[model samples]
Target: MPKLTIDGIEIEVEAGTSVLQACEALGIEVPRFCYHERLSVAGNCRMCLVDMERAPKPVASCCMPVGEGMVIRTDTERVRKARNGVMEFLLINHPLDCPICDQGGECDLQDQAVAYGKNTSRYDENKRAVKNKEFGPLIKTVMTRCIHCTRCIRFAEEIAGVPVLGATYRGENMEVGTYVEKTLDSELSGNLVDICPVGALTSKPYAFHARPWELRKFESIDAMDAVGSNIRVDVRGGQVMRVLPRLNEAVNEEWISDKTRHAVDGLMKRRLDKPYVRGADGKLKAASWDEAFAAIAKRVAGLDGSKIGAIAGNQADAESMLLLKELMQSLGVASIDCRQDGAKLDATTRAGYLFNTTIAGIEQADAVLLIGTNPRKEAAIINARLRKRWTMGGFPVGVIGPQIDLTYDHSYLGAGPQSLEALLKGEGEFAAKLKAAQRPMIIVGMGALTRADGAQVLAAARQLAEQVGAVAEGWNGFNVLHTAAARVGGLDLGLVPAAGGRDVAGILDGADKGEVEVVYLLGADEIDASRLGKAFVIYQGHHGDVGAHHADVILPGAAYTEKEGTYVNTEGRVQRGRKAAFAPGDAREDWAILRALSAHLAKTLPYDDLASVRRRLVEVNPAFAHVDDVAPSAWGAFGAAGAMDAAPFVTAIDNFYQTCAISRASATMAECTEAFVKGRQEEGKTGTHG
Candidate 1:
């Protein structure tokens, strides 16, 4: 440890600790623009200049290492004058548009200027003006407002692993943008706006919408993907203004995917605000809640339990899924499933369906094997983590799926079950690497488990995990990467079919053959609704997407942002999202809707309130007893024995932005799809960019 004195206070810090960090440890604030804790230290912005004993001049505290007996004076006259000079130079070209700038309130540059800058500037020369550059639909760029902090550049290169952004010129003529005119193709591009210290990079969708102080912020969890990223929802009046990532090191770590941040626009569009019922003409007409419930009761009055089925969606919360399961069980409806993607998941054991190693554990892993999964598209944050681990060196990743750029160096093992079989037989170099690794991980994706031989593939993957010692004591690296937020929670609540019941495919087959009479969809739009031939479909969701479009009775339910609901991430971490704004118009909470409909069916559930429903949840699965905590599932026998097929494994998410009902309805997401996904295809620029 190196002992150092800052502002007359003595403290000891780590050898490599910078003076800025040491000052911060002693409750002193040292301002800097180009300095970010997560990024590499760049001491170009001399705002954190500090006077030091026995030094020729003030030092840049951000880059200066702490030394033994070093006295750092941060509150001295020289420090203040240096900071003022830096601020003046920064403002020389900075436009006086703070009142109109979207980053006025929350900008670090604005805040630091008020505290450290002088009232008047000595130089009155012509301010440099730089033209704005395009950075796709999600980000609005104002090059003139840029402070050349290089945060965005570093974030693009290091975090996102897409080095599309960089400094193009030298000194005062410098500019940060793509070398060629192109849209940022990274899924984690929204984070650039969050890391920008000035008004240079801002959200295009959220531009000029609402100020930070004008909106009410609520801490919540994102259900956009299975990462369950902690988020802060900002609302103005009865509308959600925007969603920003919250700091959760165990999960998202201060960053969210573009969909999680920009999908708030979809909440206000294509909403199922009021209940609807198909009339005699077979067209959906707005109906009262009582009428909608009556129609459901009339259709399901004498239907046999075996003829009734329920399918839950990707974004369906735990509380709603639990209530729906209980309601179906009470009515003797055994044909229920949460795997709308028709994945052959073995819910018999918790470990089989969970990311047993946890998201944070990815950093500790020395070697990884991906089975029919693309973490880059399915879960961008996890890919970022993988890249982070890869940047530290000594971590090797092997992929057995589509040849996609995972933003890191990975060994592309063949593309089918045969490749996995080859590895299991110890016939490959990567296989040997995994066996030699201290902590090896194998991630099985939905792509591997949605086929006819999915169970067999899963079993083979488990056997490989065992062979490679991935499931050792205190470190189980066998993980299942789920793209759906509700999959784990639904599995935890036993939402799968009961004894002698059918899975999602069987339920749909029965419905198509007219063997199933009533099919209930709880926010389930991912399934093929056309297979529901002659089946009286009752859709309970907040979007008028595929499910609602083909529904016989549509019961408007709350979206994730409109209700207090529980969700389990892929890591089996239980997290809750609070209501930021009420559901549009007459849409009610999903659990409440199910609770009220139970009365219509004369099979009323026991729970009257959310608390009671949660109590029932704990009774169903004791894991629900701990909120925001992950109780690692005991390693045991999992997966079913079967024959392996020779077919190539396909990835589940072909389109990242338009995956779910909410995202499908989002104009911003559509813009992203057009600009990034489809536009890239049209432009014939599918290769990597610098």
Candidate 2:
């Protein structure tokens, strides 16, 4: 520990901690445009100058470590003078155009200028003008507002590990730009916008729209797809303005995918807001809340558990999942599952019933083994965290998957799944090198294959782990990629179907066989591919997805933004996200919809709210009983089991974005819309929100 004094207050910090961080730890405000917690320190802006007793001049607190018995003055007159000078120098060339800039309301530059900058400029000569560049879809270019703080440049090179933006010249003539004409293509590219200290880098999707203050910020979980990232929505007048990451260091660490960050635009589609049911006249008709429940009750009451099937989509929250499971059990529906990738399940289940790894835990590991999962597509935030790992004494990363392109800076890459057997035998030596390392972690993607191929991949990964002697050390384990930002929580909720239990895809397939009498798809979408036949179909979700379009009965359920619940991520840490708004039109929480059913069934779920549901979920799933203790800080002591064999296959599971029906409906998810725009847009834009 090192002792330091800032503004007359004494403090202690770990050795090598930046003086600025120490200042922040003491709640002392030292402003800087370029400094970000995640990016490497670049003291280019010279804005965070602090007075040290031993130094002749002010020092950049971001890069300077505090020394024992060190004394610094942050609010001294001398410090204020230095800060004002720097701010004045930066603004000489900046345009006063905050009105139209997307970052106008939440701009750091504007805030700092009000605090430390000289009120009036002394520059007499005409100011230099900066031109804009076209950086393409994700990032809006507004170079005139840039102060050349180098946050974006350093972030691209250091944390993202894809240094696209950089300085081309020196001093006043210098500018930050990509080589030739290239747009950022990294999975972590969206972070640059957040990292930008000014309005220079804006989001094209949200440009010139709602100001930060104009929007009502709602703390919510990102239920779009698996990885179960937490998020906050800035909404204005019942329409979402922007989506930003809500901090849960154990899960997303203030980071979210481009899809999760922008997809709330889909909610704008009016198709989702109101309660609707298929009338006896065979037309989609708006229905009362009680009428919708009555339709579900009549069909669900007549079926035996064996004949009835229920599949809760991965996007549903832990409370919703538990309620769905209980509702199925009450209806005597044994065929209840989240997503069926028995192949991934068998592998992860044999290892343990819970998350084998988490986003933050990877930072503490000595080695990482990614088997059959593409972080680039499957888990973008986890990929970003892994990329950050490479800068300071990189951890060894080994991969066995289909992608020739991996977002993480990989240490070893076997050819593909076919290379698994040979790789285990050290045929290529890449897998051999990874196994020999200490503190290794294995991550498996559920999207690797259909049920059949997943078993092959899991079996191979297990055999290789055993051959490499990864079992005894307890530093290694398995992580499966499933759907919904809350997929990790689904396991924690005891929603994993039992052996030989009919999975989601299986239940749909059974409809073709005239075997299923009733099917309840709580946010599930895969049934869109199967025939409904004479079986009664139920839809309970936030959007007009597959179930809603074709179901005989529909129940409007809450979006993640509409309800409060606990969603434990791929790491077993549980954090509660609060509901931001009332469910628009007839939308209520999934638990409420299911609770009403329990009212009719005479079987009490024992909890009146989400908290009670979590209690019940934790009791049934022993893996989650220890959730309070696994909040990332205690990860070094987290005892995760080593690799185990795959279970017999059932159905394939997709990653979060592809698995959920609601996320695909998002209009502002620019990346996702680009993928299937032709197919989706042809349906015509509903005057609703997205």
Q: What TM-score would each prediction reach against the true structure?
A: 0.99, 0.87
85-155 per-residue lDDT for model 2 (tens digits): 99999888888888888888688999999999888999877776667776655688888788888888876
Q: How many clashes (backbone N, Cα, C below 3 Å) per candidate?
A: 1, 24
lDDT of each: 0.92, 0.69
Per-candidate RMSD, Å: 1.3, 5.8
Q: RMSD in angstroms, candidate 2?
A: 5.8
Q: Which parts of model 2 are misplaced by more than 4 Å?
A: 1-15, 67-71, 340-353, 411-417, 466-469, 496-500, 600-612, 622-659, 670-690
Put down candidate 1 lDDT per residue, 1-690, tens digits, no spaces. Answer: 989888788898999999999988888999999999989987888899999999999999999999999998998888888999999999999999998899989999989989999999988789999999988898998899999999998999999999888898899999999999888889899999999999999999989988999999999999988999999999999999999999999999989999999988999889999999999999999999999999999998887899999999999999999989988998888899999888888678999999998999999999999999999989999999999999999999999988898999999999898999899899989989999999999999999999999888989999999999999888999999999999999999988999988889988899999999899999999998889999999999999999998999999999999999999999999998999999988999999999999999999888789999888888889999888889869877877787788988999999999998899889999999987788767666656533
